[model samples]
Target: MKIIAISNQKGGVAKTTTCLNLAAYISKKKKVLLIDCDKQANLTKNLGMEGAKTSINDLFLKRKFDVVNVRKNLDLIPSSVDFVGIDLLIQGELARESILKKALDRLESNYDFVFIDCPPDMNLVTVNALTASNYVIIPVQATQFSMDGVNIMIDFIGGIRESINPKLNLLGILVTHFDKRLKISKSIEQDFKDNNWEMALFKTRIRRNTAIENSQHKDYRMTIFEYDNQSKGALDYSNLAKEILKLIKNLN
Candidate 1:
């Protein structure tokens, strides 16, 4: 399976939303496993899954991963607040960085893609996600602080590559909540083009749509495509999934 971490150490950048929806969309064509790596359990809540007996916390503590099948072709390893204390618990453990990698190794043949929804912090949990992932998709917003977050994440990913996973690569930078009518959004797009980072800035920009937020608020827990296929958010995410599939094809 191609393990991808949907990461951004910047809150309000749609990280959890992207991770949840992307996995949903990708699962339509491929068997997908979504792992909620954030202590806040936003992704878990987003899916309307509660009372998970075994979560990612168990993987860190006991090296046991019991996945919950939410639907056909889609499974999830939920997260809980207990994950916040894992750093202290695993202190000085041999190969702590690879704990997640080893857990995932057991399910190597079960999924076509594995998506990790990470927290908006550069903590050990995020480190474990990066160490275990083969690629990372950064969700960025059109804000000055978001740019700084992207730079910080780039440096952090580089450090992880240097010491932990040399093969980890950036899948792309996905622009979220993009508003074509807003000059600030346009400016951010222009800056990405001028900077020309080695990784791609995805062509599909997720437009601001109330449908997406409403679905989450209502606990619908479905992708925009499933909630409202005609919505702009659905179109954008569908396009992004196609682009990701193309990239995966090229990489192979």
Candidate 2:
């Protein structure tokens, strides 16, 4: 099984959305598991797990996590607000930052792709995500500051490499919330390609579209695309899945 974390130090950059969609795509035949590691539980909500119980906190605090099937071949480790204070407990209350790694190790092989939706910070919670994950998929917003925060993520990955997981690889920096017509977006896209990336960055960038927000209201996983494959957002993310599959195949 391949464990991947979808993360960005900056919030509102489509991290949770990407994780959900990616897992849905990978579940065509493979058993995929989506973990809502973020305290906000946006993933849980998007997956229609509102007010759900037996979240990751329950698992961490007492190994009582309940896995629920959100799709035919996909399962979710639902999350709740309790995870917000997890950093404090792991640091000042329990023991260390690596407990998440231990918790996830038990379920790693149960999934073909374990997709973690991470919070928008470099806190201990994120550290455990990095330590447990074998691949890191960064979702970079089209904004100017997105590039600035790349260095911090790189540094953190460096520390993880030196201390925790050397086999961990930078899967790619997925440019999210992209606006094709914006002068800055095109310029930044060029800059992203011209400069050195953390690794082989995916050429497919996710453009900002109301369809993604629309998915939130529809209670589905870009399933709108299945109905209307000609839609731009549909075509874009589907192409992304192809690109990502090629990457994973090479890794295997």
Candidate 3:
């Protein structure tokens, strides 16, 4: 199975949203597993699985844990708010950086893809996720600050590859909340081109849309495809899924 981590050291960059929708779309034809590695449990809460007895924390703590099937061919290992303090607890463990890899090694080989939703921090949990992943997708907003975070995250991923998983590769930098009408957005897109980031940037940009936000609302809690299949948000993610599949196929 190919494991991909959705990560960005900055919040509001659509890491969780990307993880949720991308996995949902891919799981339509391929078995996908999602691991919520954020302490906020936004992914878990978004899926309405906050009350799950087993969580990603249980896996980190080496406790008995089970995956919950959230949809057809889609399974989730939810996160817990208790994970906020898990870093302190696992810091003293042996081979802490590889704990997540070891946990995943014990799981049954039943997934075509595993998507990990990492927290918006360069902490031990994020390190563990990187070590366990084969590839990473960094989501960024069309802002200078988000571009700064992308640089920091690239350096961080380099460290993880040099020290931990040499096989880990950057899948791409995804542009989210993009608005072509906004000058800042257009500037950022130009900035990416000027810096020769086109090689690493995904061609598909996730446009800013109210439908995308409403789909994630507590009352709705729907995937983009489920909420509005014809929406731009849905179309972008669908194209992204196709792009990713083609990229991975070429890589392999």
TM-score per prediction, in order, is 0.95, 0.91, 0.97
Candidate 3, lDDT over the whole model:
0.91
User: Per-residue lDDT tens digits of candidate 3, residues 1-252?
Assistant: 999999998898999999999999999999999999998999998899997999997888975679999999999999988899787899998899998898788775888999999999999999999999999999988753456667789999999999999999999999999888888888876777776777898989889988889999999999999999999999999999999999999999
Best by TM-score: 3
RMSD of each: 1.5, 2.2, 1.2
Residue 241 in model 3: shift from native, Å? Answer: 0.5
Writing each residue's lDDT as its tens digit, candidate 1 over 109-151 gives: 9899999998888888889999999999998886433566678
Candidate 2 wrong stretches, greater than 4 Å? 93-95, 218-229
Once fitted onto the true fold, the runs of candidate 3 whose alpha carbons sit more than 4 angstroms away are 143-145
Candidates' lDDT values, in order? Answer: 0.85, 0.79, 0.91
- Looking at candidate 2, the ten consecutive residues that score lowest on lDDT are 219-228
Rank list by lDDT: 3, 1, 2
The number of clashing residue pairs in model 3 is 0
| Top candidate when judged by lDDT against the true structure | 3
Name model 1 segments beyond 4 Å from true.
143-145
lDDT of 2 by residue, 11-129 (tens): 98888878877777778778998888889888998877857767888766775577899888999989887788887776764446667677777776687788999999888888888
Candidate 2, residue 79: lDDT? 89
Clashes by residue pair, model 3: none
